[model samples]
Target: MAEHTPEDKAARAAILERGCSTPIKTATGVWVRCGSRIKSRCESCAELYRGDWAAIARSGVFDGPVDQYRFYLLTLTAPSFGRVHRVPREGGQQGRCGCGVTHTTKDAALRGMPLNRATYDYAGQVAWNRDAGVLWDRTRRRLRDRWESVEYFIVREWQDRGVLHVHAIVRIARGEAPAAIELRDAARTAVAVSKVDGSVVEWGAQAQCDAFRANGDGAKTIWYISKALNYVLKDVATDADDVPVAVWRHQVALGDAARRMRCGVDCVPQDCSSLVHQRYGSRSQVVSASRRTKYRSGWSFTGLTRTVQRRLRREWWESQQAEAGADTSAVSPAPLEDLAARSRRELVARGWAAP
Candidate 1:
């Protein structure tokens, strides 16, 4: 590691004070952001994460030609392994649960608990979660075959019952757009057989989709999809402190099922160290956006990704360091070439070279 100037030292200290709550100091006394995505774990980092994704979400809707595209907000859910108590959210419609008890907002903890724990298909639920990625791939392909000029950004979030729920914003060319219900029906009916376990996976009977125009009601739709990002940051097994006994048992059963489930075709549950088992059999990313291709402008037109964001921060820091050390004789550390940040600067300053 190279030496940093007094100005560079001051900048690092300021960052340490304002960034990650528990940042780790490198051996060279350099502090790096903890890179945590959980709000509870690190509010500053997580908020930065949320803001970036929110910008990406808005970019797909607002950055494009607003009048030329149609957007739809869609939610797809997992099939129920067994009936669970359906306690309404605060101020939601009060209804009698299957167990003959009317659960109110006060009974929020019991929302996803099984009425008959003995019969709840914890194994089936975990298996479905593990295979959710495959199912979505098939669904998206199906949607593309059905619709023209399809593009999307999807988020996978946890339901109170520890199952994954998908929220997506789908975009299509204006002239080729279909009704929201048609898209929902096609997505809900799409199914795939898991290659890992050869079991069929499908969405639940319930699905919701609503179409909005970028020049019209698209902002509301973007906000709705972005709101689901809050749950995306949270761990599936989080918030276990002081929970009801039933809720704890429910989570424990799901965890056990996930642990015992096979993550790969040849996976041995007892010895496999895959984190999928720890995450309730969920191996998919919390959020996914389409990538830019030669033919299609997917997700963000600027091609913003977490890597891009990190590189931006590093570039800014390197610029500060270079400026501070201008009067000093010490050579500044070389920036990462693969990041292209330093290369772009070198090109602008000295022109492209074969070497």
Candidate 2:
């Protein structure tokens, strides 16, 4: 890596101090906004990420021929590996823990920690996380089979117990849509035989489906689902300092199990360098939306996506510089792959100092 010049350092600092707050240097040696969805990593970029997805979520609900369709908020959970304490959210009611103790909000650290760590089935938990995507794929196929017009946007979240749980915003033709309970039942009973190990992957009994009309209640439903998706890219590992010893041990056990598990059928656990092991067997994007296909309508009516969003931002910035009469004659309109090696003049034209 080459050392940055004084002017380049100033330019990078300007980007970091102003909009990005946490600019990351790419392999091209260009300083740019860190496009992380995790708030702890980059708050500005994370909120922007959340807002962009929320807009897309709203578009699927409010835009297009929504009157002819019905919307549903569906949630599916991972099967319990073992019993855990039920500590409600702050300000909520307290309940008796399985260990014969009335636990309060302060006991929240133990909320997802197994009562008996010795028999918690950590291997099964990690394996389930690894195959969660396959299970969801099977579930969506079943839904599409039942209702041909089904389209969805799904967000997978990590539970405190280091397991993956899913929430989906589904759309189907009102004519073909059945009752909420029926949809819930079908999704709950859906199963997938993992290609990696041939083990049957199934959802937990806890599932929810709530029907909401696109016109009257669509906005509220969109808000709820988007809020639920806010934690999509959050790290599953918890800081041991604030948590109890058992909870810390639980997370360690999960990490150990994930490290030993083969990510793919051909993967050698000992030699593999995949980050899935570091993330407790979870891999793949946390947020997923249906793509527009030949015979299918996607989740977004406006075809809004992260790629589109980035392109639009670039276009908007170029237009702004054009309006300001910034000279771009020195800069070549490079291909997408070469854009990362941005010219100093281009950065200066964008109102940032550069060498």
Candidate 3:
């Protein structure tokens, strides 16, 4: 790693002060960032977002009347249409997959392979991802009807089989959450009636809902949701040979099939992008809502939300300064033009000649 110059330090300080942008290296080798939230696309900004999430989750920032509210960790999964390559939950388990090999951590290639690619429901998998957000929205509405208010952070995870499911941290403003059975029943109702182009969609019957009392600072629930965000991956595999033969073929086929899928309303396409866009619009990665506020879109932050964000940014900046051994001693301010000249000189010294 190269040592940061005063210009680099200034740019980073500006980002910290604004609580936005990312640090990227410029042509002159100065570090800066545009502050994107997609983890796979930009790890630097994503880490900051993750920290913000953890802080909001653990700090009672969103939960009102902390003692009166309740929380639930809900995992809603797509129904299995066929067997797929899966890691064994227990040791010494063998022959579970068609490959008949006991898979270990070393065998990342075998993680999501299907026994029979031809029989796998690739189109259905894509459809499920598209509608998962709607199903969740309906579920939240149901919760809100019963409770005073509802706020949730939903994470979409790709199963080893390439199917999408959700792990949500659901918060109710007051009162005990309904029993798991009742919650599952409500979720089933929400899924069954959720329609795409007048056709009913289903979320399968494999919903898991676990409740947590408002106790002990709510660290466990916060940590669990934060850990869920960490599982988001940019790419499952780098090369074709990295995954099983069938899995690779299936992926290629899905890509080819998706390209042909239609976009816009009323097209009812089978491709992944088209399906997701048609169902959930362009933004579908994370869905959140608060009954108390008007902003209910994906990743939208309210006024209070901004305050929490700033807090997270301050904490991150302090931590970074500590790690870099930055001096805290005050120094006399330099003129803006002098600072610019210094940066230009450093850039020229580094071979970034002025144009």
lDDT of each: 0.76, 0.77, 0.54
- The list of candidate 2 runs beyond 4 A from truth reads 237-241, 322-355
Writing each residue's lDDT as its tens digit, candidate 3 over 215-270 gives 66557655666666665433334323455566668667555444444433456455
Q: What residue pairs are clashing in model 2?
A: none
Q: Any residue pairs clashing in model 1, and if so which?
A: none
Tell me the tens digit of each residue's lDDT in model 2 across 1-355: 2345775676466566645665544445555664557776667767777877877777788878988998888999999999987877878988888988988876777788898999899999999999998999999999999999999988888888989998888999989988999999999899999888999999998999988887886468657676667766576766334777887799889989999998999999998867678778877578889988887779998888766876777677668769999643322121123443344334434554221
Q: In candidate 1, which residue ranges exceed 4 Å CA deviation? A: 1-15, 24-31, 218-222, 237-242, 326-355
- Candidate 2 versus the native: TM-score? 0.88
For candidate 3, the lDDT comes to: 0.54
After superposition, the stretches of candidate 3 with alpha carbons farther than 4 Å from their true spots are: 1-41, 59-63, 89-95, 98-106, 173-176, 192-196, 217-219, 232-242, 266-283, 287-291, 294-303, 306-355
Q: For candidate 1, lDDT tens digit of each residue in 1-355?
A: 2335775565345556666564433343444455456777778867777777877777777876768878888899999889899989867999999999998888887888888989999999999999999999999999889875888988888888999989888888878888999999999999999989899999999899988777766457656766766665776543545579888889989999999999999999998867688778888878888878888888776777766766686677668767887422221221223423433333334433211
Give the per-residue Cα lDDT of candidate 1 at 259.
92
